[model samples]
Target chain A: MLDVEGLAKATGAGGKEKIKIQRQITLPWVEAVRISVRNVTIRLGRTMITASGIVLGIAFLSSVWTSGVIQDGLQQARFEQERELVAATTRDQAKPDGGKTEDSAAVPGEEKQAQNSKRIWLVVMSLLVCGVGITNAMLMSVTERFREIGTMKCLGALDSFIVRLFLIEAIALGVLGSVLGTLLGHLAMLGIFALRERSLSVAAKMDWGQMLTYLLLCILIGTVLSLVSAIAPAVRAARMRPAVALQTEI
Target chain B: MAKIECPECGEQIETTGIVTVCPKCGADLREVMEAVGHERDERMKTIVRDDSVTTHEFIVRTRDLKKIYVMGEIEVPALRDVDLDVRRGEYLSIMGPSGSGKSTLFNMIGGLDKPTAGRCFIEEVDMAQLDAFELAWLRCRKIGYIFQTFNLIPVMTAMENITLPMIFAGMSTDEMMDRGRELLDMVGLGDRLDHKPYELSGGQQQRVAVARALANSPAIVLADEPTGNLDLHTGKEIIDLLKELNQASGVTVISATHDLKMIDVSDRVVHIRDGEIERIEHRADIDLEVGGMGEE
Candidate 1:
C-alpha cells in the first residue's frame, strides 16, 4: 500500500499545475455515429416500426413511378402502332382522312392526363403519411429517452451530440427503409406485369435504367422526409435542461 | 517503524507510509487515512491561500443561490439564498428530507442547473459566465455524477457503460478500455465486464455507475442518494467503495444523502430543512453514534 495521503501532500502544491497540463479531449464524429447505431440496435423494434412506415410509403411511390414509366412506354408503342394504322387507313382514304387522324391522337392524350393526375395523388398521399409517421415515432423516441438524454448531458455530451445522434439514427433508418421499399416496389411491378401478360417474360420489357432512377428518387425522398421529421424532436431533446430531463419518468 | 491502531478492529498494526488495510482484522484503513489526509490538505490550502493573497481555498462556492420553479400559475421556491463552500479533496455530505432542496443544491454545484439569482463557482470559474459549450467542456473534464438509480444505459455492458464518458471525452479506444478495466477492477467487478445492467444486481449496477463516473478522472464526484436503491448491507458496501475511491484518488466527493452510513464517513455534514441550511457539522465536533453535535 503506497502512502496515498503522503503522495497527495507531497504533490498538492503542484497538482494545479499538473491539471493544467492534462490534454483536453474532444469526441470524434465517428464515435457519435457508433453510439447512434448502438442506440438503434437496442431499440430495434421501435426503429423498425418507424422504418416500416417509410418502407410502405416509398414502396407506393416507387411502384407508381415504375408503373407510370412502363405504362408510358407501352402507350408510346401503342401510339406508334396506331399512327401506322392511321397512316395506312389515310393512304387508303387519301382523298378524305385528316379529321380522323386528329381524333385518334387527342383521345390518348386525354387518357394520359387522367392517369398522370391519379399517380400524382398517390405519390402525394404516401409522402404525407410517411412524414406524419416519422414525426410521431421520433417524438416518442425523444420522450422515451429523456433520462438517457439527461445522463448523456451530465456526462458532458454537447447539444450537438444529441442532435447528431437522433439524426444519424433517422438517416440509417431512412436508407434501410428506402432500399427495402425499392425492392418491394420492383417485386410489385413484376407481379402486376405477370398478371397482365399471363407470363413472367413481360418483366423483360421493363427498362432497368428507368427502374433504377425511380428507386434512387424514392431513396432520396425517404432520406429527406426522415431528416425533416427528426429535426423537431432532435432540437427539442437538445434544448432540454438536464435537471428537468433527469426528473422525467419513462 | 511506525504503528497505528485500526479504526474498525482497534488492533495495533505496523505501518509504512499509507496503510490500505489492517493486518490484524483485514479491515480497510483507507477511509481513516483519507480523513487524516483531508484535514492536512485543508490546512495546506489555507496556508497557500493566505500566502498567495489570491485564489479562493474553496473548490466550489455558492453565493446567495436561489432557484424558483414556476409551474403554470404556481411558483415553487426550491432554494432560498443558500451560501456554501466545499474544500478540495473533502468528503462533504448534504442531508435533508424529501423536498428539502438538497438535490437542487447538488445540481447547482454540479453545473447541471442554473440558479435564478445567485452565482456558483466551480474550481474558481463562475458557471454563469460559461457558454453552453464551455459548460459542457467543464462538465466533461471536471465533474462526475452518480445517481440513486445508477443511470447506466440498460443496453450496454458494464465495460461499455464505464467507457462511455471516456468516449465522449474523445479518449482513444485502447486508452478508454485500459482505464475502463482499471475502474471496473477498482470497483470489484473485474469479471463482470460483459454483463449488462439488467443482468447485474442492484449493488453491482451501482458499482458500474461508480466506475462510469470516475472514467474521466473528474475533479469532483457528485452523488445524489447513490445507495438509495440498495439494501442496507449493499448500501454500506457502496459507501465503503466510494470512501475508498475518495481516499485513493484524492477526488472531492460531495453527496446528497440521507443514509447514516454515508454521513458517517463525510468530513462535514450540511443539514437542510425548508430549502434553507439548518447547520453544518464538522466530523470532529459530531458524535457518530448519536448523529448530533453541540452548538459551536
Candidate 2:
C-alpha cells in the first residue's frame, strides 16, 4: 500500500522517483548480458582453432570404422569362395559327408591371424592419428594465449577461473568439430561404397554405439590434454604481477 | 600559508592556494612551487573521509618494499624500499623516470603483483597471507583500477566494458546496467554508452575506463599512467575528471605517472631510484620560488 501511494505521488511528480526503494538495488541486466556475450564473441574465433584437432580425430575415427565394415564384407566373400570350392569338389568326387566341414580350410589358425592383424592395424592407426593431432593443437592454443593469460592474472582473476575458461573453450570446439566431421565422414564413406557397389549403402549402417564411444573418447582426450597443456602457462600468468605485464612491450 | 618568490619575476607570492605555475610566465610548476617545501603541517587539514567505511579501514598500506627482476642472469631491480599509506578518500600520485619503479610499486599495492620481500597491509589484513580467492575477493570488493592505455575489452561497448567487473562480482543484470549507466553519467559519457573503444577518442576511452573502475565503488583507484596516452589538452581533461572523482566521491586515488602535472595535485611524492627511496617529498615543503628568476 505504501508502494502504491509512492507510485501515485511519483506519477504526479513526472519522474522515476516513486518506484519502490528495493528497485534501486535491482537494476536492468542487459548490460551484463551484453558484456558476457561480447567476451564469448571475442574468444569464438580463437576457440575454433582449438577445436580443429577434434575434427581431425573424428574424421579419422569415422573412416576407420567404415574400413572395418569393408573388411567384414571381405571376410564374408572369402568364406563364400571356400564354401563353393568345397561343394564342387565334394560333388565331383561322389562323397557328400555328414561331417559339417562347410567352408573353412583344414587350417583355420593362419586365417585367424591374418584377420586379427588387419583389425589391429586399423585401430592402432586411428588412435595415433587422433592423439598426435590433438596434442599439437593444444600446444598451439596455450602459446597463443600467453599474454592474455598474464593480463587476467594481474587483474585478480583466480587460477580456477582461468582453468574453467580454457576447458569450456575446448569443449565447445570439440562438440562443433565432432558433429561436422561425423557428417562429412559419413558422406565420404557412402561415396566409396557406391563406387564399389552401386546399390550398397554401407555408410548408412552406422554403429551408433561405436561412433558415440569414439567421439566421447576423442573429446575426453582432447579436453584432458588441453587442460594439462594449459597448466604451466596458467600458473605463469596467475603468478605474474600487474606491473611487470604492463611494462612488457609485447 | 607559506610565501615564495616567483621564478620568473622574483616577486613574493603566498604559497597557500597559490597555483603552482607562475601567474605571469607559467613556468614549470614544480620548480616555481619548489620554494614552499612540502608543508607537512598542511596535509592534516585535507582528510576527506565519509560514511562509506565498511568491514575495514585503511584499505592498503606499504612499507619498505623492493622488486628485482632476473632476466637471463641479469638482476634488474625495479622498486626501492618505500613506505606509504593510503587511507580512504585520498588521491596520491607516484612520479618518476622511465626506469623508475612507479608502476611496480602501484602493482604491488593494488595486489596485482606480489613484492619480492616486504609487508603490505590491505584493509588492515596482510596482503601476502591472503589466499588466491581471498585476494580476488579483495580486488573485486574494495579496489577499482584504470590503466593508461584504456584497457577496455575491444569487442565490448562502453557500457559493457564498464559493467565487466560487475559480472565477475556476480551482480545481477539489472544491477549492472543501472550501475553502469550511473557511472557513465558520472564520467560524462552517458551519450556514448553504446559505442566501442575504437569509435571514441583517447579522452573518451579514458572516461570509459574511469566509469569501469568505479563499477563496484572500490575503496582505492590505482591508475598507472592513466593520461600518458592522451594529448596534452586531453590529458588535462582526464586529470580534471580524476580530481572530480576524488573530491566528489572520496575515492582514494593512487597514480603512477611520468606526467609532471600530477605533482601539483598529489598530496605526497616518494622518489624511488635504483630500487630504493632517494627521497620522500611532501607537496607543502617545496621552496617553489628559489630558481630561474635570477637566471632570467
**Best prediction by TM-score:** 1
The model with the greatest DockQ is: 1
Off by over 4 Å in 1: A1-25, A80-102, B1-56, B288-296
Cα lDDT tens digits for candidate 2, A52-95? 67667666666666555554554555566777877887888879
Error of 2 at A30 (Å): 15
TM-score of each model, paired residue for residue? 0.82, 0.72
Q: Give per-candidate clash totals.
A: 1, 30
